[model samples]
Target: MGKKDKKKEKDVGKEIVKDKKKKSKVVKSEDGIPIITAASAIILIGIAIYGYTVYQDLAQVPEMPELDLNVWWGQNTTEPQDTSIRPYRIVFSDAMESEIRWLFEMYRRPNKKKSFEDTAWNYGVHSEAFAQFFSYWIFKYSFIQRPKFLNKFDHFKTNIQGLDIHYIHVKPNVDANTKVLPLLLLHGWPGSVREFYEAIPLLTTKREGYDFVFEVIVPSLPGFVFSEAPARRGLSPHQMAIIMRNLMHRIGHKQYYVQGGDFGHAVGSNIATIFPNDVLGFHTNLPVNFSKLAYLTWVFGSVWPTFVAGEHVDKLYPFADKVKFLLEEFGYMHLQSTKPDTVGIALQDSPAGLAAYVLDKFMIFTDPANKNDPEGGVQKYFTYDKLLDNIMLHWISGSIATSMRLYKECIADAEVEQVFSQIPTPVPTWGLRFKHELAHSPDFVLKWKYPNLVGTTNVDFGGHFAAFERPEEFSSDVFKAVKAFLSFKK
Candidate 1:
């Protein structure tokens, strides 16, 4: 009876094993590869790819390019260069005055295509509002006193690396106890030394609590209004940083603080990254970090903004919305980065055309919300004569083409990332975030590029051109930042 039962149990176990094998066969891939094995292989490959991309942001940095310290950019490089600083005057000759009248006459003519009804700066510097200002610049604005205003600053030119570098040097009138620190104030495109005219007085003045006063040097960057343009290619921001370093050295400054915005931010970042030893401190209103880790952190923090946004969640979260808003303002950036010469011609040909092109930037960069108003609050923030003064300088120089060449240089060479975008600078850094600044970079992300970030000063007003628009507030912010920078150093 036991032998019969054992034989029946063995037959049942064999039937159960055959059924399990049939189900396993159904789970296998078409090529007979196990499903789990195939899934594991794909997952491993993805992890490898992810590591390759993120490693550089975390630790890997590209080698810095070997730049030519004495590279010649001028056409007459063969001749012995004049390195002596010389006094320069911004003149309005009779011939130039006649040209201004001619441009004025040309600009006064009614446009065949009128502005779309009810659209403000949304359609790019409302043609209606712009025309009225253009008329004021021509007839009512005082060109008689404008030159005097621009010339009020101490303007000088010195040849550096075969190019004429124009700058305004203003020293503080202070007591012996006060420390006068050299501060390099760099301005970006659509800006000239004129941008610093208002800030010069305030920056040079002594603050009560601080023992230091800034001896400001505002340079018209090469290819800008008074500075000579390079004759050849390859003058990216890094190269510009070299020129700035040399310029400061030439001015007897071994180490100085740097402050910038826009393309100035790009060049200043490079200076801080490559010439960290020479930069005592750095500051920027448009604080941005372009490293891969910074982007990854930003995206990762999207799920939980408290990780990256800190207290300024509204300004940075909903990454797609921020990106979309940026895209709307970046049309000019794309054009200048790709084909600077083409837009340069459009800007250089007609004074009115240049006004329309750059003033629109003034509208948006000053405050994105400016586009909502008919007048754009441009007049509210800046007086008519001063605004016209800036436009006139651009017109007089016809530098729109060459000044914009920096954009083309930076993108084409891709030198920015190799030099600083992926690299963090140890220089004591401070960020001033204006409520209306074009871009917002919270201190959390900024720390990736600026590991020694001393502090971030957040203001309720102002935008990109902080120094130009709100000199007092901008100066106060600068004072507080420099104090923090000194504290960090100590």
Candidate 2:
């Protein structure tokens, strides 16, 4: 019996040895050549894809034209008085050119921390890029007309709500058959009328079988970009609404649709509320929820123990996640709201810093679902090139400090609860809520009064900067909403 047991143990040992050899062989085979080869192939493929995208981008970027453009600086309207009723030709003076050159240099300088270097933060980075692009026409070549059209944009000064306001008006080529909607586009802070360059094609042109066209009017917000800064304190949102209404009247847009995002959203909402009869309807990509804060308070207070115990999962539905997002993302707003000039002056001087500041928000907020990140976390939602384009506008215009003050002023007068609860808009409204638009989720939005909401397009594509990132999708949604308005009328 002992001899038989010894033989059995030996047989078991042999089996174990055979199994180990098999496992070893399999591991060796996977690691030896195939895995390394596959990884190398993947890297090569990624490089190829990146190269192609870069090529495509380079190919598409339009060139700057040499049309003797002007940079008129200082107090009031400075332009060559139009004898031919043509565009007022303005050229940058030597001093102005030097200032711009300095601006670009400040942006490109190396960061305090090498690892923390932000591409967008670089000064003059945007201006240099755009100016370079503008200087040489790419194959697509239509945008060279921008500088040419610059002179055509009529600049005017008017005092509205005790603040001197400035604006640009571009009338459509009126003809016997030309029928266009009067469209008023407002710019948010850290941006100007320049942000609409990409979207202008869709905004103001005649599409085939689409009889609809637009007499596009883009404006610099009060105390932002080229618009006159407020002389006094307490420039209420409601007061701004009055100013916008008057501006529209001045531009001959008696009844027009209003579109806005960010601070533009507040302005548009206010316009709709103040002058419902004049403003036809309102549309916004950045849908705000007045009820979100109230709902969050209620939910948190009700489930105090669950929240305290770190088991509050239900609130993640919309309201809670929004709060978390606000905490995580809005540090810039907090600082700017309190001390605009502080950050503004620093960013104004450091183009790189401004680029980083603006670019980070555009990247994170636009598409929290980072398609570029292989690890499946939000690295950046926007393309670097597009991000650069927006920042360039700020840099070229030299309006970084002026832009930040909009936030500082708005926040000081911000009675969120009062504004949200008190205002009731009768104008037809539509909201295109992107996936990552925090408090703008459907569940959360439904908690508020969407009295004027004609349609809500819950887009599967894009994030905060939907207009730029997913232009086709964004345009389609915009047209659809407009159709909804028309459909109801018919």
TM-score of 2: 0.65
- TM-score for each predicted model, relative to the true structure: 0.90, 0.65
- Clash number by candidate, in order: 0, 25
Q: After superposition, how far is residue 81 of candidate 1 from its true place, in Å?
A: 1.6
- Model 2 residue 471 lDDT score: 61
Give model 1's TM-score versus the native structure.
0.90
Q: How does each model score on lDDT?
A: 0.84, 0.58
Give a tens-digit lDDT track for model 2, residues 1-490: 6999999999999999999987765553444765556777899999999988855432232222222112212234454333221122323345644675566565445453332123332221233333333333222322334335443456555554444455666566646585778777766655566556567667665666555767777777777654556655555454566677777776667899888776677777777766678877677887665543434444565456344223322323444565676786778888877887788788777655676577546656665433233322222343434445455556655667767776666767665424443444667778877766544434334324446678777655566666665666666666666656655541
True-vs-predicted CA distance for residue 384, candidate 2, Å: 6.2
